[model samples]
Target: RFGDKFIRVSFSIPTPEVERFVDAFPKVMAEL
Candidate 1:
């Protein structure tokens, strides 16, 4: 039988990493 067999889950970054990403986002977008 066809089945998922296992469950999947999503993960997120911590607050500090997110903040650093946000701060550098503009520079990242600019390069692209």
Candidate 2:
């Protein structure tokens, strides 16, 4: 039960690195 809860929280967490990567992707592609 505890492990399942941890997994849920992990998936729920928003990661800034991912957000930054996503935000930069379009500019990088546009330059190509």
Candidate 3:
């Protein structure tokens, strides 16, 4: 797990990027 790194970075990034990442997050987890 990413611990607080993901949580902290998500808030700093653009909303669009975060949304895009959100969609891809599950896909990444599945691959892992």
Candidate 4:
């Protein structure tokens, strides 16, 4: 349903929220 290597990310939240996502993203990917 998606194109190659497409990962959706949004920056529409507060700075703290975005920072949290950036911090947690790599760990999430490691489990995937």
Backbone steric clashes in candidate 2, count: 0
Query: For residues 1-32, could you state the per-residue lDDT of candidate 2 as single tens digits?
Result: 96697567656768785566568868988999
| Stretches of candidate 4 exceeding 4 Å from the true structure | 1-9
Model 2 stretches astray by more than 4 angstroms: 1-14
- TM-score to true structure, per model: 0.57, 0.53, 0.83, 0.63
The best candidate by lDDT is 3
- What's the distance in Å from true for residue 25, model 3? 0.4
**Per-residue alpha-carbon lDDT of model 1 for 1-32, expressed as tens digits?**
21232111112666687677768878988999
Query: Model 4, range 1-32, lDDT digits (tens) per residue?
Result: 33232233344567797788779988998999
**Which ranges of candidate 1 are over 4 A from the true structure?**
1-11
Q: Candidate 3 lDDT, tens digit per residue, 1-32?
A: 67699999999999999999999999999999
- Locate the minimum summed-lDDT window of 10 residues in model 2: 5-14
> Poorest 10 consecutive residues of model 3 by lDDT?
1-10
lDDT of each: 0.57, 0.72, 0.95, 0.66
In model 1, state the lDDT of residue 3. 24
Model 2, residue pairs in steric clash: none
Clashing residue pairs, candidate 1?
A: none
**Relative to the unseen true structure, what is the C-alpha lDDT of residue 4 in candidate 4, on a scale of 0 to 100?**
31
| Ranking according to lDDT, highest score first | 3, 2, 4, 1
Task: Name the TM-score of candidate 3.
Answer: 0.83
